[model samples]
Target: MAHRLLVCRIWTLSAKEIRCLPASSTAIASTSFSTSLQPSSSQVSFLSPSHGLPRSFTHTTRRQVSFNVQDNEDFTERVINSQLPVLIDFHAQWCGPCKILGPRLEKAVAKQKGRVAMAKVDIDDHTDLAIEYGVSAVPTVIAMRGGDVVDHFVGIKDDDELDSFVSKVIGK
Candidate 1:
């Protein structure tokens, strides 16, 4: 009886046609196929009617408050010439403290709306920018306005401290 039940379940699953439906019309669509035997809770897959293969969909969108600095020219063009005060985050990919501090700094900047912008510089990628700004360590944050350095700090700071630091940088 147990064997019969197991075979029946497999037969039902194999016979049923699954359709993938968009969660919402507003969401951006990207296509991917999964071949896993089991699906995780967060992921759902359905067989396409035409293709007879498992399909997955996900949607994501986020507002931009910060940008990664590409090179010396990009740094000069975006950070040094900006009308709003710009915060330069000099960091390295391998630095643990930099990983912890990057998001906190971006959150702090986000709270300020459009009053300030953030420039992320990877010390490994843009060594010239880091050296030019006198950054000898990871997670160095520098605030500048009117093409001049106004304030800076090194190391990781908590959420409240970051908010205060950002506020101070904007002189608010």
Candidate 2:
């Protein structure tokens, strides 16, 4: 005879959480979490009527958000454990400060895509990661090198400051 374990989590304004099968994987979850689980759409249009292409052909470059990943269990083997330096952003969607910081963080990753890997941990879900890093607040940003935390930028960060900080750490 064999034994199996299962877990499930559901939250307000989110779909049901069901753990099925022989438990190859398990997720630890709590009630106070919301997930934007929709299939990611690749089209984002930013067009105005006056300065757009006629009345139909309106489109903006749809940019995808990618965070570098490594295998630091706080992240994932594919993420925090990468050979290249990694930047991890610990954020919660419900946090107001996160909304303001998201774009800048994305831009930073975009500029340093190949050289650096970016990983984002949703604190609400990855409480294990947050605790591991001692993240007491949302929007905590960290730079990890060779699996250890090298530097961190908490609260809102300035682009100029971030660029210099990353370069210094990377010894660029």
Candidate 3:
């Protein structure tokens, strides 16, 4: 089905996107069992500045800046009934695009300065919530107004696109 394929596509990383990250080459032993065309080992290394560091180390100095929803009840109260528009970022810990899009969404929300509020839901932790909203992939952004879905987009959008999305959500 097309829907099933799209869900599979969201989990894949494009070569172009992978190239955007800085990396250092290092040799890793091959684990393949092939006979025809083979090398004992291959060089491989990729570096995501944040992924390499300990989470505790990264968060120590950073302010308490996230608006993560604690659970299903919290999501209903905070997002579904909030006065201001809510931007819900449904993500997962293992999702690469989620990492790329998280901070960008936060930055866009920060620029709104309380005009809009943002909420983050880890799909793994809140599977029901994700299912309720029809989220088949991580990094799915949904905008809600008056407790109704107003707009949404999937995947990693650049700064300009993110800003525009936020602006549209806030009616600015």
Best by TM-score: 1
| TM-score of each predicted structure versus truth | 0.65, 0.57, 0.62
CA lDDT of every candidate: 0.78, 0.62, 0.75
Ranking 1 against 2 by lDDT, winner? 1
How much is 160 displaced in model 3, in angstroms?
A: 0.5
The lDDT leader among the candidates is: 1
Which model is ahead, 2 or 3, in terms of TM-score?
3
Question: After superposition, which runs of candidate 2 have C-alpha atoms over 4 Å from their true positions?
Answer: 1-65, 68-74
Q: Rank the candidates by TM-score, best first.
A: 1, 3, 2
RMSD of candidates 1 onward, in order: 11.4, 19.5, 16.9
Candidate 3 lDDT by residue in tens digits, 1-172: 6545633442254545444533321111112112335443432223233333212324455443458999878888999999999999999999998999999999988887778989999999989888999998778999999899999998999999999999999893
Clash number by candidate, in order: 0, 12, 0
lDDT (10s digit) by residue, model 1, range 1-172? 6546634443345323222334431121112323455454433323334445433346666679999998888988999999999999998889999989999999999999889999999999988787888998889999999899999999999999999989998983
- Candidate 1 residue spans exceeding 4 A from truth: 1-61
Q: Given candidate 1, what's the lDDT at residue 9? A: 40
What lDDT, from 0 to 1, does candidate 1 have? 0.78
